[model samples]
Target: MDRERVVEWLEGGSVSIPKVLLKHYADIGLNEIEFLTLLHIHESIGSGNPFPTPIEISNRMSIDGTACSEVLRSLMKRGFLAIEQQDVSMMICEKYSLRPLWQKLASLMFETVHEEEEQERERSETDLYTMFEKEFGRPLSPFECETLSMWIDQDDHEPVIIKAALREAVMSGKLNFRYIDRILFEWKKNGVKTIEQARNQSRKFRQHQQPKQGVSSNEGTRKTTIPFFNWLEQ
Candidate 1:
């Protein structure tokens, strides 16, 4: 590799713009010419030239100065651009203000983040059924599907609560929907809304049953704490 070529390539400079702009340029009704113009303006601003002429912008784009000026005017009218006068060294100077564009871009960025989170949440919710089926080692029937949906929609149970209930059912050697539903019902009745609350309740319930339970092996019999919640008793 040639070092001078590398440095020269780096010296060609770069422009920084939000990823949201690339993904959602159409959302703001900006055509290729308009977007490219904005990029040039952004680059010029970054280079400390706040007031770049149409000729300067056009030199970097396919359009001429007249077309560039028209595009700039259009952007200003569309509420995506503004111009401001500022005192530089005791002399008033006109400069381009991209505050409106930045504001809109920021709004679009937030909207995209929210949209991505919603998509991820939906994916997790849909995966709950698959998790249950994998645990049970069988396909869920339509009635079972309806029951799960009822727990989520009608009962207003979050996925975490339902999953905790499922864990209880599995750990208790009672891998059935009824037992899971009973656990969830009891948790709801006792205000076990969060996963931590459910865990505390489970631990206390197991502790309460610890004294009365023992394990028998071929070697001997010994008293041991039950690790699973006895939801059947509740």
Candidate 2:
């Protein structure tokens, strides 16, 4: 090509596509030909033409006009492309918009994040089940499993707090769900939503029950002790 022609080509400008759209086109259900056709439409819009004929778009692509027209129809059916008729100076003008495609891509990204979070939650619950079985020295009964699920799904307790409660039950020699449930209930009622808060609350209760110094064994066989907080008593 001549220098002038090369200069003109270089100055003709280019289409700018969002990286997300390019990366996730197929994930949003756009095939190769459909995506290419969409890009040409985007380019034409940036070049001051919101509406380009299928034949004109196809001339720059490998597909024929009929195939390009079908692709456009498919996009319309899939809610990815739309043609709007606008009144411009007493003339009706057709314009193509890809707003739906962008909206779908945005929803797809949200769903991907939501799916990952759900997977992580499932993994955490599985680990909790394993921990419970390990502590109890046997597989959880159906009722125990159901109770565990209820604690999470209905009560909305954090897994870490529940694990802390399990440790508290073990330390207190209360190896039963009823005792653990009471511990979790007491912690939640006391605003101990975190493991650290729960531990702090337990420590404070123990400290508050500290016994005063009394006669030693050598003097009168007297003893002193800090009382343990019985969650079941409450």
Which candidate number would show the highest lDDT if scored against the true structure?
2
Candidate 1, after superposition: displacement of residue 64 in Å? 1.8
Instruction: Quantify how close model 1 is to the true structure by its C-alpha RMSD in Å.
Output: 5.3
lDDT of 2 at 63: 91
Model 1 C-alpha lDDT per residue in residues 1-234, reported as the tens digit of each score: 999999999998888788878777778788888888888888898999999999999999888999999999999999888999999999999999889988888888898899998898678678889889999999999999999999989998988789888888878899999899999999898999999999898887877654556667875888756466667777
Candidate 2 collision pairs: none
- Worst lDDT 10-window in candidate 1: 206-215
> Model 2, range 74-134, lDDT digits (tens) per residue?
9999999999998889999999998888899999999999999999999889999999999
Q: Where does model 2 exceed 4 Å of error? A: 1-14, 87-92, 211-228
TM-scores, all models, native as reference: 0.66, 0.81
Candidate 1 C-alpha error for residue 17, in Å: 4.4
